[model samples]
Target: MIAKWIKFQILDTERQDWTRGYDTARRYFDREGSLDVPYEHIENAYPLGRWLSDQRRAFRAGTMSSTRADELEELGMVWDTADTAFAENLAAARAYYAQAGTLAAPRHATALDKPVGQWLTNLRRPNGLGKDPERTARRAEQLAAIDPDWNPGQLGWTVDWQRHYTGLTALLEAGGTLDGITPGVTYRGDDIGRWLARQARDWTRPNPEQQRRLGKVGVKPAARPQKTAARTNTKARAAKGSDAFTRGVTALAQYIQREKKTVVGRHHVEELPDGTSVRLGVFLSNQKSRRDRLTEQQLAALAELGYHWTQ
Candidate 1:
């Protein structure tokens, strides 16, 4: 493909080389930003191709002398390695990223003619080349120290700790510690990072659908209390109280004062003929039992309040 274009591609019509080809290429090749002559020499061959692929690698990458140009002119054609090398390196780059467990190409990888490893190494920041096993071991030691404080199998995991967590905070909620933490059931940090990029329009832009999905798997906001149900007049409630009903109300009020929100596994509400309603929000955890039973302490409290216990 390039063979056909190579002849005219190097004509240097305005004598402009890599400079003036693209603004970025201009700054990179020559900070001065324009090739005075645009003729026979442009260094840093790597940027030449990816930065500007069509112009026979911008013609600056393999600048031919006028003598060589005239000779080629006499011969009516000249072969160039620019395309062959680009194809080989393009294939190489694909293989490199696939094996490296990454999906991004190096930002600075502006050329396709060099060894993929050369420019690729420039992008492995914060964890260069994955070469140090000792570093990994030390990080593991740090992670192992965090207590696996919460388990999420029952009553669902509390998103309280992670409500406002950034990536770092979220990581802590997931593993309890940064270093000793387990990889997710099926993902790692790199995997999550990639997935996150796709989930949003941009890092800051909002996407409602993505937000809903992330709320489930990534960052969850703590649940706020649902609105309490309507109740009958106070006089109605007071007159309908059986001894059990009276005790339950006092116990529930005390429970609410102690904990802002009631935590209940088994909840019950009853309405009397006079329109009095009594509700019981138990304290036993749903995570621990399918059936709700009062604790010994709770049973004692009710008994003291003149409520008898029965199956």
Candidate 2:
């Protein structure tokens, strides 16, 4: 309910060194509204500054005092540090914050922090707000403002689309470059984001990766992979409604029926009469997987599948 954070709006400029302190405070809060800056950065001359910094991080990390927390409640945050869920999230936030590199935070602050939006999401999810799509949309907009050319998977930590953006934020704060991360994890934000905007977004393809998460409960991935669709369409278009596709389809179908043997992954890439190439059951190419647009597997797996594509 407090917009512009009532405290930041009114600073005590009469104090010496107030300008630099306020600027630093304002900048820190402006991005994520969390405190927990290293104690060294605190302008000890102003106790108010230090308190403000601590309070924000405490709130973001779910370590707030009861009285201060009540204020957040009044703002309709559904906040609660006592909940195990909140504790788990706070723990994760602290870990991420501690690893954060060179990013500004209150000097001597020990607790790692979560971005304010992330903090709110953790707070809200336990309250049944359903992870707030609008919040993610806003975050994407913010990320776009940060880097228009951002490609997902620059960090190569996970396949989750949300992680792509979250990792981007962390990398920026750490002052790390894309080159520092594992390779081949990018998608046009425009495409990948919409893919994430849908429900069941955190997904792993079972046939591709044999992920157990989808079947663990009654959940499926948020979206069918865009890569899957593109790969399929490319094959179809390359087929061009020609008899070759019919023949290939018929042959592949017969191979399955006759072999009654399972090939772990796609066995081959067929260059149809058309310019487009058709991967037996996927878009993967032994020579082309792990290139951001597509995912590949171990060399042993590729070798087992046997290559069939011709130039």
Candidate 3:
């Protein structure tokens, strides 16, 4: 099921060209098994079909030359006959190319406008084939010297292969081995893996909010209670009030002109006997550190004092 899913994923992914699709499909089939899975289970079948149809439309739109159209047509025919096996499909495509009488034709031009033929010919050298290890080392050493922090795994292997192949010719033209051979450094897979692991850790490490969410999911950390700024400020204010309660109360009374009205709570305003209005909250007290209820006498006294008593 996983293999089938992966196959569908590969098929659905947008490749640069048919050649890239062929290469990727080959790799997938080699890693996974033959793609004989049910087509109905592939969610992107219609999308893939649409993409192929678009390619065919582009081919027929006179954008491609007659020769290019022929090549594309041959490729299409191979695909039509190909089974789910990517290697088999690639082989069939190659066979079609070989038989088309234009197998060696250049597909595109490079930055220098050099034909693909020239590029391919220049870059088709076998890996690890040089006489001197020091000479072979020069290319790798140069790459490392230029980028000390380059991850070998993540670095474009395709570009590196081209460089390694083409650089040999360049190195030879510049006067051979003794020109300047830096010692070759072979980076361990483990070191690159560790660097990748560190990168993954750095990228995915949670901020405080994410950590809290993770904690809710049963991931334990230091178990310290998160102290918010508002909570801290409130506690500090409460502590300050408790420490200087009498002075604070006195100051408040002074601020209100010292004419105490009928006592209620901290937020209630009432009229005083001196014709100056004062809040009834000035003499309010907390009973048992909980809400205090007003007695009938107290209520009557407040009402008689022209204070609006809200139930």
TM-scores for the candidates: 0.19, 0.24, 0.14
TM-score for candidate 2, residues paired by index: 0.24
Task: Give the per-residue lDDT digits (tens) of candidate 2, residues 184-248.
Answer: 33332223234323324434322332233223323346445346555888767655644443444
Off by over 4 Å in 2: 1-63, 74-132, 151-264, 268-283, 287-311
Instruction: Name the 10 consecutive residues with the lowest summed lDDT in model 1.
Output: 150-159
Poorly placed runs, candidate 3 (over 4 Å) = 1-15, 22-47, 66-68, 76-311
Can you write out model 3's per-residue Cα lDDT over 168-285, one digit (the tens) per residue? Answer: 3334445654213233411211122232222223333334443443344333333345767779888787666454433433333454445443334587654434465544354433
Instruction: For each candidate in turn, give its C-alpha RMSD to the true structure in angstroms.
Output: 24.9, 19.2, 31.0
Residue 218 C-alpha lDDT in model 2 = 34
Model 3 lDDT at residue 58 = 56
- What RMSD does model 1 have? 24.9
Local accuracy by lDDT, each model: 0.37, 0.38, 0.35
> Model 1 scores what on Cα lDDT?
0.37
Off by over 4 Å in 1: 1-80, 106-311
lDDT (tens digit, per residue) of candidate 1 on 143-182? 2222121111111211111112234344555664433333
For candidate 1, list the clashing residue pairs, or say none. Answer: 46-111, 143-179, 143-180, 144-180
